[model samples]
Target: MNRFKKFMIFGALSVTLLSGLAACGKSEAEEKKSSKNADGTYEETITIDVFDGLANYMGVQEGWFAKIVKDKFNMELNIIAPNVAGNGETLYQTRTAAGDLGDLIIVDKGQQYNELVQAGLLYDMTKYYPGMKNMARFDEAVQKMNEGTDALYGFPTSVSSIPATSPSEGLEPTFGAYLRWDLYGTQNYPKVDTLEDLLPVIKSMQDENPTNESGKKIYGFSLFSDWDGNMLNAGKQLTTYYGYDESGFVLAKADGSDYQSILDSDSEYIRALKFYFEAKQMGLVDPESTTQNYDTLYAKFQDGQVLFSWWPWLGQAAFNTQTNLNAGKGYMMVPIEDQKIFSYGAEVYGGKQFIGIGSNAEDPERLADFIDWLYSPEGVLANSSQTSGSSGPEGLTWEMKDGEPVLTDFGKKALLDGDANMPSEYGGGTYKDGVSALNINTVLPIDENPENGFSYSYTLWESYQRDNTNPVLEDWSSHMDGAVTTMEYLEKNNQLLVAPGASYVAPEDSAEISTLRNQVKSTIVEYSWKMIFSKDNSEFETLLNEMQKTADGLGYQTVLEFDMENAKAQNEQRVAVSK
Candidate 1:
């Protein structure tokens, strides 16, 4: 047998052996009570292993979020995060082949998910459907997801109650050209008209501030290799600034008007690569960037060694400590005149992330209950606290006052006071550490909570918005002609390019297409990095040409053709939803 086939057989034998051993140790009553009761509660506290594809943290979950689930369902979440396991894709495949991908599974809703269904690794959740009251809120979405399936295998994440065409993001796009507003403000906020314009501006700021507080050398551009897949994630992310979304090998325009193969000489992906090359040439790129992981890069941000950021979360959240914010020193979005930021509109069916119960779950019914609660208002508030810095649990972190939600003293301290310790009643860890480790949301954070008539996003809450402004925010607003937020400014200027959300799932790639894609992707990823760090423009051009040639020989055109068709289908959905 082949190596994978051998592993599969060994996995089956191992599972059978483990099951037999467990059966021998279990008492008849213990076995009987292990399954969920008719009341949808477990007879005893159970440890639920969550195979989370999106989790940034791994191991057993703890702190306030843990306490909430434990108190409610007598369960503890033991998260198995592939992202933190070193190699996410490999971990996923290995666990999948082992026939036990944890009791609760969260992953992308695509080929891998279909494979799991075909392998009977996913539990049929149809029996518990009636009890999923909160989940039923997205009835149309769920129906669309399981259209051809015999049973309700799973549902997508970040579902919204808003119309499909409306933008779901509260106050920021997923990607942006964020900068240290404190530094920019000092420099009189130089005008940035295009991506190229950012280079000179960033260099000027870098020259002025050579080091951070502790005198650590700073860089205008610090990249990470950890998140790179088919192409450099750092480079690919730049395409979003121009309103393009990654669709397999192609970058599909947000308005569904155009698509470009990443390998195309003049494509945005290539342009981004050249941008990084120029940054490197100018001595503004971090020397350790190519070798650094995301964690290292994020730590650099916290130390204020980075001046530019592509996402609101990365630069703003990591670096904007309470002290910095209090001092009017923090990061904020700096708009480029020629940019049209891509926005994934509030998806009524949610984004492509899928959550389902594993077939090997000890108590699938109880898991069903846990997942259902995630869709409830209480769960949305508590579980999605990471969403745009939202607070959790009405009484614990926030409460209604004068018919509007406001943060309590504890909430303010825990959330904004830079890792304040939580009360012993709320699992005792620092508030930051106490947030959910799953890192997946059942509903959009921007979705309005029916109970409060406000978005689950604390940043978007009227009371919070009114009280949250600092000097940095005020300065940014003034610079942007009184535009209070990046999303607002983008919308006002027609600079936000939203891909209308629809109940659309791209067709699974053909076996031939999948194989071709893997080979082509490997080549692209390897050469893309080489091109970015090339010795000179001549070397870069040579590397790029070599990469394209090799990839084309490996069937780049075949995969590109497949992706183009998928892109066309995606556009059709966008059009349908727009109507």
Candidate 2:
């Protein structure tokens, strides 16, 4: 039997079992049905199965977020996380073959999504679009995806409202060198001229504060391998510090002026590999990096076992609790002079992922309402709270005070306290557990909410700015020309390389190209990791040369040509959009 047929048989068995159970409690079921409110929402609680490609957490969504959805729509979410389920790719293929992705679907906007669209797996969400009040703001964004087709598959996630030319991030660049402020402060804040300059500075910090309070040794860098793809994700991420963004396997300069093959000896990727290798040699690199996942690395940050971070969000958010900041200890950006940090400008059409309903949805209209709510200001605040630095729901976490937003006492604790607990009414749990598990946002937190006249991000709120004062921040400000924020410093010094947002979607790869890409990607990732942990310089060079030669033999040149053309198209669109 085909997979779809097997899925049907399994589903039928489930229905039969459910029917038998229902028969045993017929009167109770009838009473529950009668208890539903007069509103459009069903009285019988419905469980919506969400197959989310991006989710890190799985199982029934719980805590305050569950309460919010239940109160609003009488619905429970059963999240299906492919990453957690097993091998992500295998799960995706199996589910697709079974003819039921889920009641709702969320995935990145790439080959998989395109294939789903062509296969008619996604519902046409266009009819419900008219009813989505907040979604109107991104009409062009939704339309952009459905240009060649008559049906709308879904709306993109992380849609930004800022001008296309404006920087997407607020207080800090997405990629930068963040160090523990308390440690760096002791060194009189040594200047970081090049990426290599960080070595001695990190060494000094690690030497002085050799261990955490619990007596575990700290390292300058604690990396993870969970996100590796076409190349070592950490290594590719390091290239962003030098004003380049990965376009397929190519490193395209942010200014749209140039590109480099990852195999090039002088490429930023190689430099990043060498940086980690040297850090390893200096005993500043974590030995667990190759084996550890992101969660393990993150826990180390919370314990103050890591001294360096490439992104402010990862290190700063994990380490900078209210307690730490109060004690003048936290991570803060220590800019490198040679860095022209690449910044993604506002993406009005969203980024790589999108949210859509599956074709097998039992209640399309109800699911549509739920999705529409995701685009609403209220839903945005509730779902995105404490995520990407957004202040959550107005009355609960924050309040409008003196015509501006301020975090309430609960808000402050809930938002910044590492071990905060929610009130029973909000579904008692730790604040972290209460956060939305979908792991996808319909709009970026940095976007403005028209109802409140403030961006969804708490970092941009005037009240937050006024209350953000801390010993660490003050010290950093005093040392850096009184610049209160990293954004201000980068802007004033003209060090940010903002990539103008354009409605550019990379074309789907041909089948031959796709096969070649997978092979080349595997080789690149394998060699990249090997080079980072190579025994010596000679071994590192051998690994590098072998990687390049093997990749070329596997058709790297063809892929590079394809990516170069995309770079050209992207540059043209960026220039036009900026104009």
lDDT of 1 at 72: 85
On residues 116-146, what C-alpha lDDT tens digit does candidate 1 reach at each position? 6766678888878998998888888888777
**Looking at model 1, which ten-residue stretch has the lowest summed lDDT?**
1-10
lDDT of each: 0.79, 0.80
Q: Model 2: clashing residue pairs? A: none
User: What RMSD does each model have against the real structure?
Assistant: 5.5, 7.3
Per-residue lDDT value at 451 in model 2: 89
Candidate 1, residue 184: the lDDT equals 82
Model 2 scores a C-alpha lDDT of: 0.80
Q: Which parts of model 1 have CA positions greater than 4 angstroms off? A: 1-41, 385-387
**Model 2 lDDT tens row, 1-579:** 000000100011122333333223111211222333567666668898899877778899998888999988888999998766757766776676665678889876656567666555677777667877777888888888667778787888778778888888878778888999899989988998999999999999999989999999999998887677667888987798888988778898878877998889999999999999888888998899989987799999999999998888788888898999999999998989988888888876787677888776766667778888888888888886344777777787889988988998888888876547888888888777878888776887788898878998888987898898999899989988899999999888888998887746777777677778878888998898889888899999999999999999999999888988888888888888888
Instruction: List pairs with backbone clashes in candidate 1.
Output: 168-346
Number of colliding residue pairs in each model = 1, 0
Give candidate 2's error at residue 33 in angstroms. 16
lDDT of 2 at 34: 35
